[model samples]
Target: MLIDGLQCGHFNRGVFEELRAGAVSCVTITGGFWQGCIESLDAITRWRDLARENADLVVLVRDAEDIDRARAEGKTAIIVGFQNTNLFDSRIRFVELFQDLGVRVVQLTYNNQNEYGGSCYEPEDSGLSRAGKVMVREMNEHGILIDLSHVGELTSQQVIEHSDKPVAITHANPASVIPHKRNKTDKTLALLKERRGIIGCASYRNICAPEHAESAEKWAEIVARTVDLVGIDHVGIGTDRSHGHTLADMHWMRMGRWTREIDYGAGSPENPGTTAPLDWFTEVRHIGRIPGALGNIGFSPDEVEAICFGNWRRVYGEVFPGGK
Candidate 1:
């Protein structure tokens, strides 16, 4: 029962089949990035439609039991999530509406700041505003898991202290490992653990050191080091594996209506596009290889299971309403 904490791959019957092939019991895939209310609704509707169209291959996950049911039925469970809080459009009550529409996880910010707070790329780090605080409590009341994968450090720290629920850093590595702005600092990781939260080891190559991108063993070492920092129970996999989208779509992800000039994002002028794929994690089905890499790194079978599945299951069960 492997539960991937985050993915943003192209959704299709083929992708769903690949998820089954990977034996991924549940996956929290991105539904919206910088989309506002209307666009976000369209994204959610598309996902719902895809689940209906491919009922034999997948089931929509509203709770942890749905994941168990999908595994028992030999199907993959799809958990819809957003990479930004823009879907709310500053209307707090819409959180419940989106949750009803099958959204379970939401990140507070993307690469840029919005109504909620500052982002990783923003120059200022004002932390959470009063409305951001209200939004946190509202999400808590409605059982939406708060993800701070791309949020600014100051903002993320404030959220960890304020959110009643245990938040998630759904797709990031440690700054101590790679020293990237997108990665979390050791202090942030410590606060997350203290709050009983979990951090998913992001497999995006840019988040990792360049020299180690192609080595599965080195990637597993990152996971191990993260576990060493925040206990095994608070770590899991977030394969930021994206597929089926064109370079234009990728650009949209990087500069979503915010800039006129091209934003290279993690790439530079010499390589101004998506990061090269990690050799061990280019496709969704490649996740099946992760457990072996963990085992090779001296993780016990039970410990490997916790990293690949149990830890995420515990977080989902605790965060989702009626999941426990």
Candidate 2:
């Protein structure tokens, strides 16, 4: 199926083409990531226009019901999402605006602290702020999924306790396996699973060790570890592939933080100096390598299927119904 987290800027066209070719079934299309209100609005508008033009290949899905219907009709469904709450800018009302525009999942922060809470990369990891608590409640009330992939540890814990509904870690690893700041510890993973939350395994190279040279086998190994730690039902694919971008993109993600502006201060930088080159963008062929890697790990097709897309379908169904 089409498993995705965010598709912003000019990369939407190629992504849509892939989906049309049956490359995947559904995509959790992320629109907001570190974008201010104006930027988020503009991005959503562009996505709407694109959806209209590609109506044959794309169906705007707001709920789990639409995903089921789209799969039955052989059309690709797009689930809108956000990687950071910077779009809200600490204003709770914007959650409704984003919900109106079809955003379903939202991460509380990026790699740095924002008004809502500290990022996983923050030095102190102060957890969710007062505004973040409000944001979580608002998201729950509106049926928007709260994603904690890049959020600080304390904040992630607080969100699990505070939010009534199941939260999500859209893209993260098991810290016990890889020991990266971006990864969740085994205890955190267990807690989230206990709460019936979902943990999406990211395919981004950095999340893997020795960042510059990680293969699909390495990714599968990580996935297996996560599945072993957490149950198969709670796991899914996030991929986190920023296809069509370059090291320039990585630098932009760093936002000059590589210069030590905001130190995470706890452990070493997650996958330091392991940024993938622009050439990686054109090589979608690597995606299929995952199945082979899973084979090496001795996972049956049924288990692989769950990790690849089945688990995501189950979770998406619970979150959005007919693009609600």
Candidate 3:
């Protein structure tokens, strides 16, 4: 079974059915990005509606048992997760509230600095404030997995050092592979492995060089290298699929009230709002390409299974309450 470790897509019945057809057992849906508490609530409500309206194809996840049941029924489980806690906004207590509301993962910062810490894009990276430290403990206590996908280097390091439990950089590539700003560094990856943490290699093209934009073969090689570097037990795919979204949605994701000026987030000023997903991974049904390619690249059957599914399930079990 496949588990997309992180996703921010335009969901609909077609997408849900594609996941089922692709044998995706679960998808950790993005519950909040730059949106606030009220907006977050609205998004959650919409996801609830998706689960209700499409019960035959998809269901919302509240615990690990939900994943197992969904898999058994050949339905995809949608686990609510936050890419950033901008919604929690000034209330430490909201962390627990959101957890109760079914948020299983959260990143402390986004592309820019927040009240808690600096972003990966910020010019000056403030590691973590006193409040951010509080959040680390709060999330650990409340069972919300701490994610460092778009956090600044110092903040990510601090998070790895501070958290008593293992944390995840859920949808980031290794900087060693692509050398992008959002990718994790060698030191951070090593520390995370030492602490028994999880890291999911992303397939977003901005993390890769321009020439390899549509290469699934290269994407598979990237995943294999990640496993070789971090060990298969600690790696999986957080492919960052954004299928079926329009320019308006991309603008909101890139600009997000933080700026009035337009920013070409994916490095193509000529093509402002587009992200390049590999040709073979443009949809959920194409997920088999990565794992299939791994089998040809010297991974044993057990190791391929671990990279595609078992590894993520193991991490979810360790971090989320009742996780399988």
Best by TM-score: 1
Better of 1 and 2 by TM-score: 1
Query: Tens-digit lDDT track for model 1 on 1-324?
Result: 588889885889998888888888888999888899999999988988999999999999988789888889998888999999989988889999998888999998898887788898888888998889998998888889999999999999999999887999999999998888889999999999999899999888778886556667778899999999999989999978787777887899999998899987666698777665787767778788888889998999999999998888888888887877
> Which residue runs does candidate 2 get wrong by more than 4 Å?
5-9, 20-22, 210-215, 256-274, 277-282, 289-292, 321-324
Q: Estimate each model's TM-score.
A: 0.97, 0.86, 0.95
The models' CA-based lDDT, in order, is 0.88, 0.71, 0.82
Please rank every candidate by TM-score, starting with the best. Answer: 1, 3, 2
- For this target, which candidate reaches the highest lDDT against the unseen true structure? 1
Off by over 4 Å in 1: none
The per-prediction tally of clashing pairs is 0, 11, 0
* Residue range 1-324, candidate 3, lDDT tens digits: 788889886889988878877788888888767899999989888988888999989888777778888889988988898888887878999988888888888888988898889888888899988999999999988888899999998888888899887888889888898897889888888888887788887877778655445556667777877876888789887878876777888888878998999876655576666775776676668876776777877888998888888877777777787565
Per-residue lDDT tens digits for candidate 2, residues 157-230, read 88888888778898777889877889898878888888878888776555666532455665677778788898
Off by over 4 Å in 3: 210-215, 268-271
- CA displacement after TM-score superposition, residue 211 of candidate 1 (Å): 3.7
